[model samples]
Target: MLLPVVALLAASCKKMFDVKPEQVVDQTQMYRNVNDADAAILGLYGKLMNLAKQHVVLNELRADLMDVTDNANDALKQVTLNNVASNNTYADPRAYYQVILNCNDVIKNFQIMVANKKFTRDEFNQRYGDVVALRSWVYLQAGIQYGTVPYVTSALETIDDVKDESKFPRLSLDKLIDTLIKVTDSIPYKDVYVTGSSLVTTIDGYNTGKFFINKKCLLGDLYLWRSAFTKSDIDARLAAGYYKQVMETGGNGDYDTYRIKWSEVTTNNDIAVGYWNDGRVNQYSENMLVDDNDYGWRSIFARGQDALYNTEWIWMLYFNASFSPENPFIDLFSNRGGSYLVKPSQAAIDGWDAQVQSDNNFPYDARKRLTYKTLDGQPVIMKYLYNYVDETTYLPTSLLNKPGKWFLYRAAQLHLHYAEAANRDGRHKIAYALVNNGLSYNFDNSPGAGTKRDVTNTQQTFDPETAYQFDARYGDNPTFRAPWHRNVGIRGRAHLKALPVNGADSTTLIENMIVDESGLELAYEGSRWADLLRIAIRRNEPAFVADKVYNKLVKDGNGSAAATRARLLAKDWFLPFKWE
Candidate 1:
C-alpha cells in the first residue's frame, strides 16, 4: 500500500527528532554556540547522504544511459521502463522532504542563535548560507523528480501542519525554479567557507569541504535551468557569468589551477599521451586479467580522496563503511559480492566505442574501460568498485561494508555548463572550443588579418567579444600565464579528436556535442537525465530526450519503447505523485 505524505513526514520527524518529554529541549539549548551550529549543519549532510542512492537512481535509471539487469527487482525495472508506480520504494519523496524540513529547522533557529549573541556575524553568514543553498538544492531535486512539490520554507510543527494542503500547496516545476533562482541569488555568502572556519575542518578522516554545496555552482545551475525554461539569452548569460565565477574562484582567484594543462600528459617519443601526468599505470586493458591502478581519466574516481581529486570535484558526499546507512550503489551496480541490479546500457557503451581517441591508435574512448567492463561475461560498472581487491575480486565479504562515493559537481561539468550557457547566449565558437579544445588553442589559431581561411585559420571562426575571449596568450611574459591560457578542452584532455565545428547550425551541433561528451565523461554520475531534460526543455523538442530513451529501450528489446517515447512527446516527463 502507498503511504500518505503525512505518514512519510511523521516517520521522518520521529526518526530524526523524536525524544522523550524529559529530553526534549528548547531551541536556545541547541543554538548555544558555533559547535552546536556546526553539529546541526553536519546533521543535515548526514541526512543528505542517506538520500544519495535515490538521487543517483532517479536521475539515471529514468534516463537513457543506465539500464536494469535481469536481477533488478520490480521497482528498478518500472523506473527504467518509465512506468514508475506510486509504491515503488525508489519513488519515495519523503526522504527529500525530510532533508528540507531539517533545513527549515536550521534556517529558522540560526537566526535565534545570532540574535542571542551566540554566533558572530561571520559565523552566522557562512553557516546560514550553506543551509539555504543546500535546502534549495534538495527542493530543486524534489521538483525535478516529482512534477510539483509542496514548497515549504518554515518547519511545520505537527503532522496536521504538513497534511494541510491549503497551507502548503504544491508548486509546479516552473514556479519552483523561479523561486529557487530568486532565493539562491540572494545568498549572502556565495563563496566557500573561509580558511580556518570550523566547517572547513576534517571530520572522521575526510575533508568536509566536499560535503558542502557550492553557492556559485548552485547559482549557475539555477540560472542555467531558468535559461532553459525561458529560452532567454539574458538568463543564459547570467548562468555563464556564475559558472565563470566558479572557474575563476577555484584556485583562490587563479583560474589556471583548475584548467587541464597540455603538459599534463605521459610523453612517448616526444608525443603527448593525453593522460594525466600522474605516474599511475592504466592496468585495465583488454589483455590485462587484473585491473590495477586505472589512472589517467579514471584516477578522478579510483584515487583516494586527496588534494588532486578536490581540484576537479566541487562537491562529493563520502559514505564510510562504519556509518549507519550502507552504500546503496554496492548492490545496485556491483557484480562482485553484491546484487548486480543494473548495468551500463548498450547505447551508452556503443556511444563511447564510436569515438576515436586523439592518439589515433584506439577506436574507443579509454574512459569507457574505466566506466564499465565485462567481468565473468557480465557487464559491470567499474567506477564504484571501491573496495575491490582486483578487477574480478571484491574484498568485502559483505558488499554493504564497502564505502561508496556520490558525485555532485566537478570541473569538467563546470566547463560544459558554462559552454551550454555561452552557446545559447550566441558565443557558439567559444562553446565549441570548450568542448573540443582549450580556449588558448582556438585563440592562438584565430585567423590573422587578411590570412586565407585554409592557411592561417584551420580553426573555426573565433568570437571577438571580450566576454567570449579566454585570454590564453602565454610565453616568457609571466603576466600572460593566466588561468584561461592553461585550458585544454574537455575532449582534448580526454585525448579524443575534436568534433569539427561548422555550418549555420554550429550552435546546436556544439550543444549536442556537449551533451554527448557529458554522457561519455559523466555517465552514471547522476546527471544524464537532467542534462537531457534541460536541452529538451530549451528547444521545446521532446524528441531530443524521447529518442535517446527510445533507443535504450529498443536495444533492450522492450515492447514499451514506443509507448515511452509517445508519453515523453506528450510532455508526460515527470514521475507520478500518486501517494495514496
Candidate 2:
C-alpha cells in the first residue's frame, strides 16, 4: 500500500523527454512557458510526499520489536545489532536518493528557467525559492538519518550518468549543515504558496497557508538540526541561540491553543510543519482500539486484546481510511482474539507494575507514567483511542469515522528539546524548569489512576499500592494484564518524574536524565532509536551492553544483564549502511 506518486512522476518525466513522443518539446522550448515551471515545482512537492512515506516506515522500524522484549525484531535485528550481515537487505538507501533526485531536478530545472528569464520577477522568485527550500529539506533528512551521505546536487536522467557515483563523495556533517542553512536562507518564509485552503479567508484561494512549508516550519527544523549538531560539535552558546529562537517563534505554546479537538494533532501552527492520519479520530483508531474482533488490519506489534495506546506519539503519519488494511497499527490492535501474534515480555510486565506502584508515591518519581500507565487503576491515556466501532461485532460506525491530522512539531517536544539543550549548556535550573513545564500537560489526578480502588471520603478511591500489587499478581502472565491496566495511575493523581537534582552539571547524569525523559515523553513515537544513539554518543555508554531491558516475556532475553553487556561491546548497535 505504499503510495506510487514517485513512480508516476518519474514515468511522466520520461514521457515528456522521450524522443518517441508523438510531439516532442526540446529543453529550449520547455522553459519558455510559465506552466512548465509550475509543473516542475508541483513535482517537487509530490516527491516530498513520497519521501515522507518512507520516513514514516523508517521511524517505526527503528524502535520496532520482534516480540516485546528488547531483542531486535526480524526487521530491526537484520539492520541493527546482533543480526547477520546477510539480513541487511531491508535498508533502502535509494528511497532517500529518490527525494534527493527530485530536489536536484527542481534545482537544476528552476535554475535553467531563471537564467532564461522564462518567468516574471515574482514568479521566478517564488518558484526558485520553493525548490531551494525543498532541496535543503531533502538533504537535511538524509544528513540526520545516515550522517555522511552522498551529496548529489545535480539530477541524472540516465543510469549510466550515475555510474561514477564516487565523484559525489560523502559530505562532512558540518559542511552539510552549512549547505542546508544556505539553501534555507534563499527562500522567503511568508511568501511561499501553501498546499491547502486558507484558514483565515473564506475564499477558496490557491494559497491556504495551512499545510504547506512556511517560514515557521523551516525555522523550527533548522533549530532542531542546529541543536542536534551543536550538542556534539559546535559551541554551547550557538546551540543555546538556536533553541532560544525556537521558543520565541511560537514553537513552545499550549497544545489546546493549536490542537484540533478530539484529534491528536493540530491543523496549522507556527511550530507544526507536517500532516499525518490522526489515528485518534480516524476509523483506524476505532477499529484498533474499540473493535477487538477485527484484528486482521491493526499494527502487528500492539494488536488484539493486547493492543495498547501510545500517548507519546506527538506526530503520526496520516493513513487513508480506504487504506486501513495496509496500516500495520490498525491490524495489530484489532481484536480478533489471539489471531494476531506476539507474547508480552516479563520486563514489560515488571515495568508496568513498578509504574503503577510509583504513581501513588511509592519509592520516588515514576518514569513509567511518562512511558506507560499510572499505577493506581485508570485507563491508559486514550489519545489514540476512538469509540466508533461496536465492541462485540468489530464493525465501523459512521459516528467514529474521521481523518486525523498529523502534527509535525509540537510545543511539548520543543520544551523537552530546550531542556536537553539547556542541560548541555550547563543551565541545570533552566533545564529542570523546562522539563517540569513539559510534564505538566499530561499529569493525572484521580484515585484509580493506576491501581485498585479503596473507599475514600464518600466514593471508591484508587489505592496506588493495591494497583501495584494487582499488576504484580499477573506479572508472569502477559495474557491477563490488559493494556489499559498498565496505566491505571494516569487518570488518578498528578505527579512529575524526578529530574536528577544531584548530577545536573555532570555530563553522565545529564545524558542519563535526557535519555530517561525521552523514553518517558517520546516513547513509541519513533524516537527511541535516535534518542538511544544520541545518548550513547553523548555519554560514552557501553555500545552494546547486556544491561538493556526490552518489555517482553522471555526469561533472561536481550534485556538481561548478560545480553546488555554483550550489546554494549557490540559494534552493530548502530544501524549499518545497506551495502557496508
Off by over 4 Å in 2: 1-73, 76-89, 116-147, 158-163, 172-240, 250-317, 321-407, 438-508, 542-570, 573-580
Candidate 2 lDDT by residue in tens digits, 1-580: 1112222113123221112223324455454546666545544454454444335334433332213223234654433233325335445556566656766665676677767777666676766666666667667666656656667777776323333557777775557877777666656543435333112121111122333344434544454455455564333434444444433432223222211112123431111111233545542221222212222112211222121112222222332343221223322222221112222233433433443221233432233322223212322221122232343343334433432223344334544555565566665544554444222122223322333432122111122322111111112123322222222111111133344366335645654555555544444444445555444544545441224332221342543434433554553453344442
Put down candidate 1 lDDT per residue, 430-507, tens digits, no spaces.
787788867656655542222222322223234454335465554432234555655778887777788876565477
> What are the Cα lDDT values of the candidates?
0.74, 0.40
Indicate the residue-level lDDT of 147 in model 2: 59
Q: Tell me each candidate's RMSD, in Å, in order.
A: 5.9, 13.8
In candidate 1, list every pair of residues with a backbone clash.
256-483, 358-495, 438-489
* Cα-based TM-score, every candidate: 0.87, 0.58
Error of 2 at 359 (Å): 10
Residue 218 CA displacement from its true place in model 1, Å: 0.6
